[model samples]
Target: MSRREKDQLHLARINFLNLIGQSNPSDAWKLFCLVTPNITEEQVDDQAETSSKLTLTTIPPDVVEMIVRTIDIESEKNVRLTAKYLKQIVDARDTMINRVHIHLCSQTVGIEVHEVTKEEPETYSFNVSVIPGVNHIDNAVKKFEEIISKPNTKINHLKIDWVRSEENRASYDELLKSLAVSLADFVEKVHVEELTIDVNAVEHLENLICSLKPDILKRLYVIGPPTCGNDKFDFSNIVILPQWKHLSAFTSSCCELICPIHHLYHISNLRIKMASTSPIDIVGYRDTLIVSQQRIDHEITISHDMENTKQMLEPYIDCSRLTTCRGYYIRSNEKRLTFELKHNKIIFSTMQFLM
Candidate 1:
């Protein structure tokens, strides 16, 4: 026997004696015999006679069930393929799945799991991509249906991303609707995270959000270029259900924000695009809303309010751009600065109270 094999045999024998001592005495003695090379032919014959009938059911109930759940699902699958010990690990209970990624780029729908317990939480930018590939649509969808429909699983995070092109948008929307329908059927009430989707139609997006378990969604981001010949989805029909206890961020392409100030301001962050020359109605109302837009508000100045004024700038940053109390145009290529908003304008300054 190889050194590794001998070591494993020794370890198994110890585990057999420790946990399976009294109840599984038969297994205990057989393991002891494997570790002891000097065992008699009588014992070998007895083991041979009984080994064929020994089933995994003979193991203790708890020992038979080993819950191995994680964000690194691929690694678990690979290990299970090689080790019987791992194959015996069940996917059902005692598992805490912090993030669930449904990778759509590959031909096969990839279900990746990373093992994280309740005490530690992990984060990821939820994205869904459907690049042209050798993907079999019907088979892939079926596989995804099977994975998401797995019983006895509590998914805390879920997202699928889809890229948009004028030619593929309508088709893409249909696929997204189908996927959302499937998810709603399986996914129950749970906390949601960053979901990057292409929302070509408002009704589809609204229906998908409504399907999710209410009140626990933390963040849902709608990203991608505008669809329908640069026309934006009218956000008039969008309604915030009472169940969305934690729904905050909702940013979509060219989508307008209108009534329901309570829910509107509840959105602490949003990214908007400048579609027209007319000024957007975002300047007056202030409710701790952080707005990010493609157009830099020339009227707004960024103020630096750090305790130490000079600490705001990096060592390599040009000091010429720094001002005592004036708003400067921010170019992302130059340097990133800490900023706050005052009077509906972005403010950045050093050695002065900004707001």
Candidate 2:
């Protein structure tokens, strides 16, 4: 035999012996006779029948169920592949999935599902290759449904990443559209808690966010590619969605938001991008926080000139109170709102009190 084969056989023999020692002692001698190479043909024939009875399928159902319950999702999937009875046992149980991430590439769609247990978190990856050969979109959707559509599966977070390249641009867009449609169909069933998407197309992002069940989704994040001057994205439709209106936390990174700033005032935690923040916008933000009873924290990253923005807000700077080099405060009654301008970021915080 080859060196690798011999090493593997040696390891297997040691493992079988150790397992036999820990378990029932009566089967040890029988298994020992089966493993020993020097045993005669007649001896092998005698133990063949006994060894057949030791197959994994012969394990008691309750014991098999207990074993499958303790393993991670991937291990449970492997156990199901080993035998039909094991598959049945695993399918009967429900598993808690912590996160599901879908990555859309030019030639392939990748899926990552995570399961958290007492020991550690377990991750499972599934990739559907669309490299110009097979049924592209249909095959990908089929594989996606197979993995995420498991009965009684609960997912806490869902993230879709669109990483399209210039080479296969057309195919990538089609795949993304198909997947987004498929995702919209099952938004209610998954009960996704937090959704973070990196989409290049504004329409797709709006559609995806609007499709989410409003009552179930609480956190939303939109991460777009970096943009230059005068290139702003329209999120007018997104702000109107019930899902967006009810979001407890919202984050928009790298892309300049063109809509009115008032649409974001209700979110408890907000991180958004604006091409420019006018003096009127700043005053409105401060006024909203002052009379509000709810807690609020906001971080606005500006793409315009920092000096110009500071000069514009100079008139409204509450100079009567103590002011630092780059820090400005806007206070009303007992509530004090602070605005800190550092490089391209504008941070705003409010001290809220009960009436």
Give Cα-based local distance difference scores for all models: 0.43, 0.60
TM-score of decoy 2: 0.59
Candidate 2's error at 1, in angstroms? 61
In candidate 2, which residue pairs get closer than 3 Å at backbone N, Cα or C atoms, i.e. clash? none
Stretches of model 1 off by over 4 angstroms after superposition: 1-95, 101-138, 184-191, 227-232, 243-245, 251-261, 273-284, 287-355
Per-model TM-score, in order, reads 0.44, 0.59
True-structure Cα RMSD, model 1: 14.9
Worst 10 residues of 1 by lDDT: 293-302
User: What is the clash count for each candidate, in the order shown?
Assistant: 21, 0
lDDT of 1 by residue, 1-355 (tens): 5677545544432343333345466865664444344446474444444332123323334533232121133332322222234323333333335566544442233445443443443332222337564334444455556544544344556655544445555546656677666667754633344455556666676666765656666666665543344233544455556434465555554343232333444444534432332233333322122233222212222132333333332232333434332323234444233344333233332222333
Candidate 2's displacement at residue 77, Å, is 39
Best by TM-score: 2
Per-model C-alpha RMSD: 14.9, 14.0
Per-residue lDDT of 41-131 in model 2, one digit per residue for the tens?
Answer: 4643444434322223333335443543443443323222223443454446444567778766665666677754224543334345456
